[model samples]
Target: MRVIAGTAKGRALKAVPGTNTRPTTDKVKEAIFSMIGPYFDGGLALDLFAGTGGLGIEALSRGIDRAIFIDMDRISVDIVKHNVTAANVAERAEIYRNEAGRALKALEKRGSAFSLIFLDPPYRMKEMDALMLDLAERGLVEDGAKVVVEHDADHVYPETAGAFEQLKYARYGDTAVTIYRYNPVRSEHPMEE
Candidate 1:
C-alpha cells in the first residue's frame, strides 16, 4: 500500500508476506485522516498491534512529531522499521517488538503519553476491550487525545471505558473505525461531585 497524503504521499510500503497481518487500505486511510483533519501537528502517536506500520507512518508523514509502533511479530516489526527508514521518517519513529498489552505497560512506566493511538489487532483476537482498559488504567493516552480502533464491523465494543468517550464510529464494508477521546474532567468526577 502507498501513503495517501503528507510528505510520504505516493511512496510505496512493503507489506507482510502472509495473512498474519492486514494493512489498512488507502481509501480507509484517507477517510481516517480526513476525519482526523490537520490537528496532528507535533502530536505524539502510538500504533498498537502495528502490522506494516502504515497507519503510524501516515501520521508521521502528516507532521506528527513522533510515533511509537508496537507489534509482536518479528516480520512485521522488521517491515515497519524498513518502511520507516525508507519513508525518511525513522528519526521520528520507534519500533517495539512486543505484544500490545506489554508495550502499553512499558510505555506507561516510561511516563510517555500519546496524542493519538491507533489500534488494529487481528479481527478474531477480541482483545480491544482489554487493551483499551489497560491504556485507561495506565494513563497512556493524554487528555483529549484521540484513539482510533479498527475492527470487524460486526464486533461490539464497550460503550465507555474510564476516561475514554466514544466520539464516532463508521463502517467500511467489513471493517469499522471507532474514534475515542480521553476526557479527564468527566472521568475524574463521574457523578459530578
Candidate 2:
C-alpha cells in the first residue's frame, strides 16, 4: 500500500507479515480521512489496534503532530516501525507491542489524550464499545476527538458509546466504518444513523 495523501503522499507502506493482521485498504483509508479530515492543524492520534501503523502514519502525514501505534504482535510492531521509517515519520511516532486493554491503561497512566483514535481490531473481536467506554472513564479522549472504528459490515454498533456520539457510518463492501465524536456536553441522546 501507499500513503494516500499529504507530506508522505505516495510513499510506499509495508503490511505486517503473515495473515494474522489485515491492513486497511487505501480506498477505505482515504474515505476515513475524508470523513473526519482531509487534513489537520496538528494534534495527537492513537492507533489502538494498529496493524501496520498505517492509520497513525497517515494521520501524521496529514498533519497530526504526534501519533502512538499499539499492537500486541511482534511482527506487526516491527513492520510498523519499518513503515514509519520508510515514510520518514519516525520522529513523530511512538510504536509499542502491547494489547489494546493494557495499552489503554498505560496511556491513562501517562495522562495522555488523543485528538484522534483509530480502532481496527480483528473482525472476530467486538470490544469497540467497551474500549470506547474505557477511554471515556480514563479521560484519555480529548473533547471533540474523533474515533474511527473499522469493522466487518455485519457488526452492529450503538448510536453512542460513553461520551462519544456517532457522527457518520459508511460501508465499503465487507468493511464498515463508524466515526464518533466525543461531545461530553450534549444531552444524553444519540443522533439517529
Candidate 3:
C-alpha cells in the first residue's frame, strides 16, 4: 500500500507479511480521509489493530500531532515501525506491541486521550463492540472526538456504546466504515435520543 495524501503522499508503505492483517485498501482509505477532511489539525489518534500503521501514518501525514499504533504481532509491529520511520513521521508516533484491548486499557491508565481513534481489527475477531464500550468506560475519547471502525460490511455494531453515538456507516464493497462520536454535553444521549 501507499501513503495517499499530505506530506507523505505517494510514499510506499510495507505491509504485514501474512494474511493475518487486512490493511485498508487505497480506495477505502481515500474515501475515509476525504470524509474526515482536514479536521486532523494537531489531533491525537489511536490506531488499534495497526497492521502496518498505514492509518496512523496517514493521520500523521495530514498534520495530526501524535498517533499511537497498537498491534499484537511482532512482525506487524516491526513493519509498522519501519513504515513510520520511512514515512518520516516517527517523531509523532508510538508503536505498541500488544493486544488491542490491553493497549487501550494501558493508554487509559496513562490518562491518554485521543481525538480520532481508528479500529480495524481482523474481520472475524468480533472485538469492536467490546472495544468501543471499553473506550467509553475509560474515557479515552475526548468530547466530540471521532471513532472510525473498519470491518466487513456485514458486521454490525450496537446502536449505542456508552457515550459514543454511531453517526453513520459507509460501505465500500466488502468493507464498511462506521463513524462514531462522543458528545459529553449533548442532552439527547446515545440511547435515549
How many residue-pair clashes does candidate 3 contain? 0
Against the hidden true structure, what lDDT does model 2 obtain?
0.92
User: Where in model 3 is the C-alpha error above 4 Å?
Assistant: 187-193
Indicate which candidate wins on lDDT: 2
Where model 1 places Cα greater than 4 Å from the true spot, the runs are 190-193
Tens digit of per-residue lDDT, candidate 1, span 1-193: 9987789888999999998898999889888888876446688999988899999999999989999999999999999999999888999999999977778779989999889999999999776767877887887878888888999999977767777888888899999998888888998888987
Cα lDDT tens digits, model 2, 110-170, are 9999999999999999879888989989989999999999999999799987778899999
Candidate 1 similarity to native, TM-score: 0.94
Candidates ranked by lDDT? 2, 1, 3
Error of 3 at 34 (Å): 1.3
160: Cα error in model 3, Å: 2.8
lDDT of each: 0.88, 0.92, 0.87
Backbone clashes in model 2, listed as residue pairs: none
Pick by TM-score: which candidate is best? 2
All models, RMSD in angstroms: 1.6, 2.4, 2.0
Q: Give the per-residue Cα lDDT of candidate 1 at 49.
A: 85
Between prediction 2 and prediction 3, which has the larger TM-score?
Answer: 2
